[model samples]
Target: MIFFLIFCVTSGFSTLLNQDTLDVIYRYVQKTPFKKIFERSGSEASFINEAIPTAYDSRAVYPNCKSLTSVLDQKKCGSCWAFATTGSAADALCINGIANVIPSPQRQICCDNKCLEIPLKQCDYGCNGGVLTAASLYIENNGIVSDECIPYEENSSKPCFTSCSKEGVKMEVYKGLYAKIPSIMKVSENEMKKGIMIGGSIAVAMNVFQSFTLYKGGVYNRTDGDFLGNHAVRLVGWNDTAEVPYWIMINSWGTEWGMNGTCYYLKGKNLGNIESQTVYFSTTPPTYHGRQVSVSFSLIFIFLLVSFTAVLYLLSYVCGRINEGEKKRDLQEKEARTQMLREIGERRYKRGLKNRSSSSVRRRRLSSSENEDEKDTSTRMIDDSEEEEESEKDIEKVGLLS
Candidate 1:
């Protein structure tokens, strides 16, 4: 993968055939030191939210679009259609007053398996891939599944029976809202707050270019891959700030893939920002505003990371000292043991009158014991020096305030 990624960087395309966008993703992934950086990448929240932090991935709902609140698949198989269909069904159900619940992809693959014209291949539905629209259309025609009757039988080798179809159910489709604006920053917070709780999906339009791959990190003016994803998303709402009006959009990728699992369209560049990875996502408006209650929660996350790091350093310090102390005690014990052994050897030598030439091994062991004490002292000095340096970092450098 590393060789292929570098090759894509040099060639301005990926070897994944048509998956050139993946090359851009590779560039960013290679450079990313932290996998979870995007979670904290959004602009600082307003004073209210700044006091608290929000943990919701921000994309998990819709803006007055009737959130389906259904289960989402993370591409366990190339069966994107199942996720999309199940997702759209959740939206449709909420519109029809159905409660939020987990949907089964197994029913579609098991009962219908769509046409099943060709014999099953070894890799079928086993993360190789499948059509998402087919899954949605199949669900629409065959109706949804029951977990007890047809739970998720993902990546199944056996194809489903043809007669195991559910009766197709009718659904209502609600068109998502869209508006052209000079800037997204112009959207007011009051206007944006309610969109989150309403629950819906959104689609964004952009000029997608090849450089969109570089959207992974740092900054980019252009990408080096083909546009391969959607730009539409749910409009949860807006930040009211006149300085930086931004609409938060969620994408169907993981948190490591983009914008801490969400995207913020910069005020001027939200449009035609293919190189910027402007993509679509969903969320609810009221829930969006309500998130402000814990806006300052980001600080807590930062505090936890710092605290954990400090504790690790503290443990190393304490452990090092304890280890050194133990080594010192062990060295003392060893010297005592060697001295007792030497005394016994001397007494025996005296009683038997053994010649020096025969007792050479004992003599060398005694000499080694003497050198070990010297090495121990040297190690002790080095450790004491390290302790002094660490103590210095803990002290604040004071300046004379005149």
Candidate 2:
């Protein structure tokens, strides 16, 4: 009875674990758009004539291009589309002689908002999720900025400035032009190998399983785990000579995952539909010497000349107005002074006339007073003389009478 009870408990736990794994697989399979996987373009014919190698690795071929060997981390954001696209483009640029530049995945994620405009299975919703083809098209047309221009932001809310944010780096200098991807095509396994050899690296999509996440090393061929969602990665090379025959892939899960952020998928079977779609780009190196620079310089020179002329004309006009105002003010001040001086002279003349009139009045009053005093004196003397005569006459009579 004890043994039977233990067997029952073990069976029950196994059933529960199986059920959980089925649930995870069901969710991933439901999320994948299976219809898009079958869509094919006939561009594989272009590479049919090229010789195919048994095993090739871009890192071994282009030893100087560090981007081909370096593994980037996408963090928690679902920005694998941006990283894969930009990584493949960077490898191509370095392989073509434009050296030492890793294109900005952040720029692609934030700035390329027109992914929805292009009719694709999925739209690029930044960190939420995105389509691979839409990202490739953006790099082809708009041309991506260098990683030095804008570093990757794990935050989904990062905004697009569309300009170089790094100090001492001009947007025009690092931001290149004429990034060309002849075509975005879905090809067979052999065709994908030829494409990688012809071009440096190719961006490819694959379905991820739960077991893929825990993968540490070895040629990964396990398809017996919980199916995760689709992921985008760079297909750098492949080895058909291996026991399982695997395609070399560079992942954006950081160097700690897999074999230093690299993995191997079963090549011929297209186990994760990696060969279903692929993209590559080629660009001409920018030249600072030649007609392009001359035209840019000419435009700049013309702009400076026009600006300088406008400033000079404005200064001259202002100076002329100021001089005219100063001259008018001086004339007005001079007129006021002349008027004031005239008024002062008039006041002085009026004051002089008033003083002369007062002097004449004083002289007349003095002369009239002197004349009256003289008249009084003369009258008193006359009266005294008359009295004296009368007294003398009386005295004479008295003496005669005595």
Q: Tell me how candidate 1 scores on lDDT.
A: 0.41
Give the TM-score of each candidate: 0.31, 0.56
C-alpha lDDT of residue 209 in model 1: 54
Off by over 4 Å in 1: 1-73, 109-133, 146-157, 161-199, 202-260, 264-402
Query: What's the distance in Å from true for residue 180, model 1?
Result: 22
lDDT of 2 by residue, 171-250 (tens): 64232322222223446676577657655788887788888999888888867688889899998999988888998999
lDDT of 1 by residue, 1-402 (tens): 644543344344212212212212222222244324322222222322532222122234332332332223344444444444444444444433453444455654554454321111211242344433233324433455443334454554656634333345333222221111112223333223322322232223344455542356422334346755433233333443535545554434445644554455443443454223211212211121212312222333345555776798799999999999999999999999999999999998886765565578788888899899889999999888888777665453332322
Report the lDDT of model 2 for residue 172: 42
Q: Model 1: how far is 137 from its true place, Å?
A: 2.7
Q: Each candidate's lDDT (Cα)? A: 0.41, 0.69
Clashes of each: 57, 0
Which number leads on TM-score?
2
